[model samples]
Target: MAIRITGTGSYIPSNIEKNEDFNQHEFLNEDGSTINHHNEVIIEKFKAITGIGERRYVENNLNTSDIAFYAAQNAIENAKINQEDLDYIIVGHNYGDVKHNTEQSDTVPSIASRVKHLLGIKNPKCVAYDILFGCPGWIEGVIQANAFIKSGIAKKCLVIGAETLSRVVDKHDRDSMIYSDGAGAVIVEESTEEGGIIAHESATYALDEAHFIYFGKTNHPEITDQRRYIKMYGRKIYEFALNNVPAAMKSCLDKSGYDISDLKKILIHQANEKMDEAIVQRFYKLYKMKMPEDIMPMTINKLGNSSVATVPTLYDLILKGELEGHIINKSDVIMFASVGAGMNINAIIYKY
Candidate 1:
């Protein structure tokens, strides 16, 4: 049996946080005073480097599950399937719901369960759970759904990638601007035809570089808990991406018996524009050919990095014809790849 993505949907919060807002965003010194830097210069430099001018942030009134529920509902509607037909609901996330006032992370009942309840899915047979594998969690969720379908365990499954990363990041830190909030979802169902995920490859480089971007304290230990917020060694992660991501992508293509020429578009993680461009460039070099212009689509400039939500959201836009000059044909091939925290990397190849 073959597995196919029948529908896709995404939700990005309406609230936009511009880079200029960070100027007065309380970047403080140890004793609670401003750390001196030309805020305008920093904002411009950040835009030039990451290609991000603004990103959406969920308001205090909302939670991760809320966004996931919306995305899942939209996906179900798009797939033209009855809600009761869903056999599984798998959510990919890093931090569960975080209560801002209490600074608490809650995972006792999985976010997927809450989403299932809110969707009014009353089927007792529909399994729902969460997965954590750094930024690759969503793709991993899809991979597991594939196993379930191919093994005759499921007929239809909903895979969702949702994150409210702004809640986990220290607004004062330089890395904070790269994180945001959003959710994306897809309906994967058993198909008699052969136009779905053809092949995939993934791996983890368990090293200190893995810790380069992780959940940890603010640099000023006097102010907050030791493992409270997100922090990173940018240079270390940049190096790791350049060294590992392209190889994993190529390995995935090879597994599917494909070459660079076979793919129409490549959707990569929207973490850093500079790094994403570099990774694709390196992947083409492995074939001794240059990547075609406009072959890679990016949303990082506007969406920032919503962790696992990025690629699925990008795919949803393309499918809806919401992106300019980006469209898929009846049998086009595409590749998706990403690398992030865990030093984890993953790739997927599919036909449309």
Candidate 2:
């Protein structure tokens, strides 16, 4: 009765624009300094502070769906499961290719549908949909997929988390340098396997302290009041996460009848290297167990913050042999924790 990740895959843009590349572009600040610049001094500082060396980038014309298409195809092939077996395709994305049409244009559904046609999955029951959450979107997608499977509504689900963060990123802002663009996918199927998604728990604190990060441009009191681009009071969010994420992790671990020591690896939302280290240090002090080494490299550097795409992309990196000898193993207990806009935090335990 577990949802097993049968296969994992990712699609990074072939074009990698290093921080230094941005210096040549029109991305500059008011004081005539490079806004998205990354020279030797800046790159070294970024690596030292965030533990990120580089990030992926797509051309200006491409959109989120295009990346998701490639990622889904790779996942299908990697899993060796016939595309016909996919009864559902659920996507977690902060930005779709296009928004607000009379139809589902430039969205995940259209992307999945196109892939289905290409792969020859003709069944009408094989439907696709999208889910929106900040960084924790992928976790929410998996949990929802699990519910559909448990209720016998779906036989197999393609759960994907992808983003074209550069599309919304304010390139003129230095804070946006920590973000990049990419996509990742997972093939989740109901199985009798002993290890998979053991427990999932989430918490959404009232946006009393930090709600300014939510971004949208419209002024409609109902829909546009929230800011549409990604913004955060870094220090405030960091303190909140340091306090909340560990508690949520403890809650999920307890539900699964496991402890931090039982976990073989931990994959947190790769938002900031500094924040990740801060949380890991706290955990080490409390439990004396070593923190998962994956805290760095997943974000704040390469691929920047791909928003919802971070976890699944990191998951794919593990599967693609990038982290093969480190941090993960067969049947190893893995933990995923996320903190995003809406000031929400969630944690889940899984096994591979």
Candidate 3:
């Protein structure tokens, strides 16, 4: 049984915020006159580093659900499936319009229902709603949907990865360069046809040492309720990505009964440039494998890291000819790999 991605769609905000615009924001500079060299350097370096020139940002009136609706519409249209056929809507997101105490208990059900109503779908049987592993949530959603659809729990499912990470970024902080807003979606259906999610695998490392990405304390004094902003140990994450992501990728491929040469393309998470290079170099040196030149294009440069939306948004660019000259073939197998904040690493093997 194969779960096919019949249609793919993505929505980027119309607002075009360029590098010079970000540089002129004044908050990017530390002391008004003196700018941080690393910050300024990365803004310029990322263009050449990742190949992303611009990313989309929804304005004040828009929310994740709104962007998601647009992407879903496009995917639905592309899939050419009737609305009545959709039995599930899984939204993979970290930040939502409203805050919640736990990741699992967010307003995703309300979101799914709202989207179903907007689409005029007849009594859609929505199921399995929640935010899974932050940036890796999108892949997790697809895997879950695959299981359900294959098990006869669903005939058609819509899996959407949407994020508004810009809301949580501390604009004054240097790490703010990695957060952006966007959404992307795929319509997965039970198909005997080719080109869909084939095999998925997940692995976790329970390391307290690597848990330096968050801003909250385990035991904070006072009756503290706070909106903790994003903080990352970039060097630590880079090291972690280099060490764990490749192993995870290989493990996933092995589980799927595939070899290094069997894959046609690789879409690693759009976190940063340096980490992506490490994985590519390791594959070349150890496995004697050559990654496609366009595999690690600069998506984070314009959009920053749209959390879960990263890979799907980049997929849109490739499919839309914005990322021209990239060789994606009809029967090509692609690998999606990532090292997310939970000290979690995941990889999914797909045929497209």
Candidate 4:
């Protein structure tokens, strides 16, 4: 028996926000001081570093749960599984549903519960819950499902990572450009297949890096009304991820007993372009090999960073042939990795 991903799906928002759209807005520093650089130069620098030209945002009428439901629905359909047979629904998200123009997050019912309701699954045995593991949440969800299935607790599970980061971003901060809204999901099940999830690794570095990515007051501190938005120390996060993520990936792959040469693709979190490139390079260097061309597929240029949603969304797109020049064949070995708030990091080595 193996814990395998049977199907995958994602919800990419229809509304596109281009980098140039911020040209007329006022960008501010953390101390409420105005940025001396022109908006054009600032945006150019951001694009050059992050490789994000545009990002998607949910419409005013939609919330995080709404998109999560969409992705879950698609995953269920893609998997061709009966809703009543699902054993669990796990959602990973940071801020709950933050409505348009609202600062408060509504999570009383939990996003997983809401998604289960939206999916209309009637089985009482279909347990549902949410996780807060930063951007690695989706992979972590899959790991949890694998545990449940391996422990004889579940047969099928729906794992989703959804976020409406645009609703939680401080528009005046430059990092706000990296935030986007999206959701991704997958159906994991116990199968007789020979290849599946082989190994995984997870870690949290809260001792000194607890607040690498956090929610704090807006950069424009003058208009303070107790409204906090998503904030982060980019330099700290970059350094933290570079120093740790690659090692975690190496550990996972080593545990899987697969040589570095067996890896067909790496679906890493779409946090930053340069940072991701460096992590992959370092990962390959550990094995005394150069990183292979096209070994890592990316979606950050168009999707930005949607936290937990990045990894699964990229996987869904590639599996569905939506991401060009990326394909996974039967029995192919691949890895999924991510790092984010909680200063958390996680990786999974799987066989297709």
Candidate 5:
């Protein structure tokens, strides 16, 4: 039996923050000093290079688990299954529940547990946990789910990827423009069908690269909220991803006993538009073929990079035929891959 995705759903916040709307005033020094920077030039370059126009952010009162709950609700409904039927709730996230009004986090109960509670799931037999694999997290969750089902340890699992990156993003940092907020989910269950998750691959290159994206002190020192946000070396991450992601994808397909021509789509984490394009190009090059632009659908332009949420959210969009250039039919082969903090990268080939 294969582990199959029975349903998929996503929830993006309504608040829209455009690159052009951000000013230099948002950035600051830890001592409350200003960091002088050209906002217009940065936004233009960001839009030109990343192909991102804007990103969504949740209100001050919301948290990661809250959005995860909404996404899980939709996936459960789409799967036509009751919440209690879920054998596990797996959440892929970089940060846990962000404190109200701040980017600081609270991980006491774990986001998955909180989501299960918010969904009113009463089954004591249902297990819940968190997977911290940077941007590859959601896919990692599903991969683990596949393992459980194939081993007869589980019947159904709800995998979720949700992030409130705005909470951890420093408004003054240009790199922060790429972070957004959103949630995506899927219902992975046992199936006797011919296609599901065919094969997957993962790798770690943490040597000096783990600090590429990390937590650090915030600019505001006297503020009551925790002064912590995401910090990174953008160029290094871009280089690492473009160089390694393609190899990971290729290995996954080859290990799955498939070829580039057999794939229908390549859904990737929306970190950088140009980088993703290059990665796909390199992937096909390994097979001595040219990549068809339409073969790899993109959401980086509108959603930015929501870390763990990127894969599942974009997958849901394609699965539901919500994008113009991207669509998937039953029995089509699709590949998924992502790389981020920890220098962790992974890929999975599935029959949709």
Candidate 6:
């Protein structure tokens, strides 16, 4: 028996926010001081470093759970599974649902529960819950589903990673440009398939890096309102990921007993282009080999960083032939990795 991903789906918002959209805003430093550089130069620098030309935002009428439901509906339809037969619904998210133009988040009923309701699954045995593992949430959800199947607790699971980072961002901060909204999902179940998830790794570095990425007041400190937004120490996160993520990926691949040469594609978190490139390079370095061209597929240029949604969204796009020049064939070996708040890092080695 193997824990196989039977189907995948993602909901990419239609509302596009381009790089030039911020040209008229007043970018501010952490200390509330105005950035001396012109908006054009700042945006250019951001684009060059993150490779993000545009991002998507949810419609004002929609919320995170709504998008999660959409992705879940797609995955269920793709998998052709009966909703009543689902054993679990696991949603990976950071901020719950932040309505448009609101500083408050609503999590009274968990996103998973809301999604399950929206999906119209009435089975009482269909357990549902949420996880807060930063950007690796979707990968981690898959790992959890694998565990449930391997332990005889579940037969089919719906794993979703959804977020509305745009609602939680400090517009005055430059990093705000990196935030977007999206949701991706997959149906995992026990199957007599040859290729499936083989190995995984997870770690949290909270000792000194606990607050590397956090929720705090906006860069415009003059606004005395108690509203807090998503914030991070980009340099610290970059260094933390570079120093540790590659090693985690290596460990996962090694545990899977697959040689570096067997890795066909790496669907890494769309955090930053340069940082992701460096991580893959370092990962290849561990095996004394050069990183293969087209070995890593990316969606950051158009999607920005959608917290938990990045990896699964990228995987969904490639699997559906929506991402050009990227394809996953039967029995292909691949890896999914991500790093984010909690200073957390994780990787999953899969055959498929």
Residue-level lDDT of model 1, residues 1-352, one tens digit each, is 6799998999999999988889876564334456677778777888998999899999888889989999999999999998898899999998999865558888879999999999998999999999988888889889889889988889999999999998888766777888899999999998888789999988988856667767766645457564588777888889989998999999999889866798999999898999999999999999998979989988888888999899899999999988888887888899878887787899999988
Query: In model 6, which runs have C-alpha deviations exceeding 4 angstroms?
Result: none
Considering summed lDDT, which 10 consecutive residues are worst modelled in model 2?
218-227
By TM-score, is 3 or 6 better? 6
Q: What would the per-residue lDDT of candidate 4 be over residues 225-245, giving only the tens digit for each residue?
A: 999899999999999988999
- Give one clash count per candidate, in the order shown: 0, 11, 4, 1, 1, 0
For candidate 2, write residues 217-336 as lDDT tens digits. 322223323335444566688888788777777778889888766777677788888887777667655666656565433544666778788888888887677864555768888888
Residues 282-317, model 6: lDDT tens digits: 999999999999998999999999989999899999
Query: lDDT values of the candidates?
Result: 0.87, 0.72, 0.70, 0.94, 0.87, 0.94
lDDT of 4 at 198: 98
Which window of ten consecutive residues has the lowest lDDT sum in model 5? 23-32
- Per-residue lDDT of candidate 3, residues 283-342 (tens digit): 545676666566555566667678788877777677666765665678778887766777
Question: Residue 35: error of model 6 in Å?
Answer: 1.0
User: TM-score for each prediction?
Assistant: 0.95, 0.83, 0.85, 0.99, 0.94, 0.99
Report the lDDT of model 3 for residue 118: 68
Off by over 4 Å in 5: 24-37, 219-226
Question: What lDDT, from 0 to 1, does candidate 3 have?
Answer: 0.70
Candidate 1's C-alpha lDDT? 0.87
Q: Mind sharing the TM-score for model 4?
A: 0.99
Question: Which candidate do you rate higher for lDDT, 2 or 5?
Answer: 5
Q: Which window of 10 residues has the lowest lDDT sum in candidate 4?
A: 215-224
